[model samples]
Target: MTDLLRLDHVTKLFPVGGFFSRRSMKAVDDVNFALSADKPEIFAIVGESGSGKSTLAKMMLGNEVPSSGQLSFDGTDVAAIRGRAAREAFMAKVQPVFQNPFEAFNPLTKLDEYLFATAHRFLGASNRGAREAAADAALQRVGLSLSEVRGRYSHELSGGQLQRIAVARALIPNPKLIVADEPVSMVDASLRMSIVNLFRELRDELKVSIIYITHDLATAYYISDRVIIMQKGKVIESGDARTVLEHPTQPYSIALKGAVLPPDPAAASAIIRQRQVVAG
Candidate 1:
């Protein structure tokens, strides 16, 4: 089957230093992947800071163009999408959830405004009644409702609540794909799992394909169907999430797995010993 999204040898480069001593730094280097149109699953891109995961996400979202190669959605080149009509159509199919929920909205604005605007713009809820109904329905998917956040400002809600609202607003368009960058990293530890589980529900129930970009391996192991480990702007390992994580082939992947200490001290010690043996 043709993919819903495909990145064919994509590379992004940015210039650094003054004009006289300019040099190109490759942010994404020959990256390639595909997501099936009929399949909805969470695909994780895991790497530490400066690994080019964010660059890949931005290219996928069409926020940035690749210096080389093609990025296509539903067999259409993302770069070829031009004009208001085309961009709007693309946006209706793809949405984003940022890491910081607080920064996603205005402190002074009512939370429902974003929700209503999304519904009105994408879902075609032109009137008050239609917009309200649409907003309420989308919010319910993320375990929230317009009533709870109707007149509330961003500062009033907890981090978890704000993140859920962000998810709700993204769902207002019933997008086919969502690119979430470190989505749960900002929420409280107690509530992180709930948000992770929400992504699972979105994939299984709504059939929405998700590109879940994060540095948290534990949550990536918990939520992703497939995982890609990146290093220095290149994919080091890519395969089934559990298999790749549990039996990582690359040295970097092995090191990453070893870095995640088990909750129990005894188990953690055992893992450390095992990793030491592998290293030896």
Candidate 2:
């Protein structure tokens, strides 16, 4: 179980005021967590908007550099990764699935092109035959296929389908760690679980570790093996998903748990009725 990622007192600060003022704000403050290379699991970064979970995700993706502390991947410093080849190598192992699938894809470009391009870029599938094979195989893992997506535009597919294709593109790289920042937020309610469940399949079948960043506690509790609750750029609670979410010790965590809707419709209706009576 080698260290896949390590963050030693990591912090990210952004300039707030004008150049004259020189004021700065902390986006991610003293955060630390590690995922093992061999033991892949779904790790959720749970928080609301402005909690800095997305910033943390960006830092992990190397799109943003930390202001202080060490951010390492596989024992190498992420900020120190210099040159296109080194960065490309790092990208091959770590991929990103953004919140909105439509925004991630080009409306004009054919869907298959994105898949084939990823296969070519990361997996080095130069020839059309090899590229198509790699693309189709990756798509199949996400319950989609090249035939379904080929020659289709982003607008042609449903949000769920586009998101699945996004996952497949990430999979084409054979990545060890995927930083999916609110991957299912833009998807429809009925399809949300399918996308959430896909992460479990990815961890179990493909052995890919996931960094699932989202504000949805229900989905987090459903999928995550481990979780870290973030509040105002700082971690409030961190532990096993079941233990922490079910038996939350922190005040905020407890409040969050109370907000989760009941699974049973009858029970949910009862709560709603109770709330209505209280309001009345």
Best by TM-score: 1
lDDT of each: 0.93, 0.92
Which residues of candidate 2, in runs, are more than 4 Å off?
263-280
lDDT of 2: 0.92
Q: What is the lDDT of residue 213 in candidate 2?
A: 97
**Cα lDDT of model 2 by residue, 1-280, tens digit:** 3899988898999889887999888889999989988899999999989899999999999999999999999999999999999999999999999999999998989999998888889888899999999999999999998889889999999999999999999999899999999999999999988999899999998899999999999889899999999998899999999999989999998877766778899877876786688789
Candidate 1, residue 182: the lDDT equals: 95
State how far residue 90 of model 2 sits from its true place (Å): 0.3
Q: Write the per-residue lDDT of candidate 1 for residues 239-258, one digit (tens) a residue.
A: 99999998999999989988
- The TM-score measured for candidate 2 stands at 0.94
Against the hidden reference, what TM-scores do the models get? 0.95, 0.94
